[model samples]
Target: MSIPNEALQKILQEIGQKKAFAEQQLAIVKQQMAVKTRENRMLQLTASEVDSLPGDTNVYEGVGKMFVCTPIPDVQKRIASESEEINADMSNLQKKQDYLEKTYENSKQSLEQVLRGGGS
Candidate 1:
């Protein structure tokens, strides 16, 4: 059966809209990943600084170090969790984008086939 031009155009438009939405989502995910990475780096730097302080120099150095390092583990864990989440989100987004691209290509090919009187 041959598809109408109006139907084909509508499908193409819908595909374009979906593709644009996916691109937007990917951009936001990228921005979120960047922010999370920066936060993780800052946490690591603070942890390293705390570890580098001299315990014998200050009477409260031990307490300071312990206090600082206490939440380091939690922060590290959170960073890892966030990183994993971001990776999963990006992977899923890429998969969706790939599928949409393939769909667009297939639709275009089908439209071409219809136009060429080779409907199947």
Candidate 2:
């Protein structure tokens, strides 16, 4: 049987709206992923710099290095702790990204089905 024109139009409109919303959500998720990755990279760099510090060496070559070497022990410990926190945050964001991806896919499929007039 042929689908009613009004019903088909309504379905198409709804589907289009849903697909657009899902696309917007996916964009937000992408932004979040990028931010998380940048933050994680920064954390790793800080941790590496801290790890290279030699606690026993009081005198250093450069001014910046000398300052860092002053509180070598504390700085190393703080950076290690921050790195752990950033890692945890990264794991959580990864899980969120996976979930958002699945949601986007499912919404797209539903929209396709609706537009095709496969409604029950």
Question: lDDT per model, in order?
Answer: 0.59, 0.70
Each candidate: RMSD to true structure?
Answer: 6.8, 4.9
Compared with the true structure, the alpha-carbon lDDT of candidate 1 equals 0.59
RMSD (Cα, Å) of model 2: 4.9
The TM-scores, one per candidate, come to 0.50, 0.66
lDDT of 2 by residue, 15-87 (tens): 6777677678778767877886787788688667756767575533246545334466666666678777867
- Residue-pair clashes per prediction, in order, are 0, 0
Q: Clashing pairs in model 2?
A: none
Q: Which candidate leads in lDDT?
A: 2
Count of backbone collisions within predicted model 1: 0
Cα deviation of 29, candidate 2, in Å: 2.0
lDDT of 1 by residue, 1-120 (tens): 766878866765765666566566656655765665676566567556645756533322135447333344454465568657756766775676566556656656655554566333
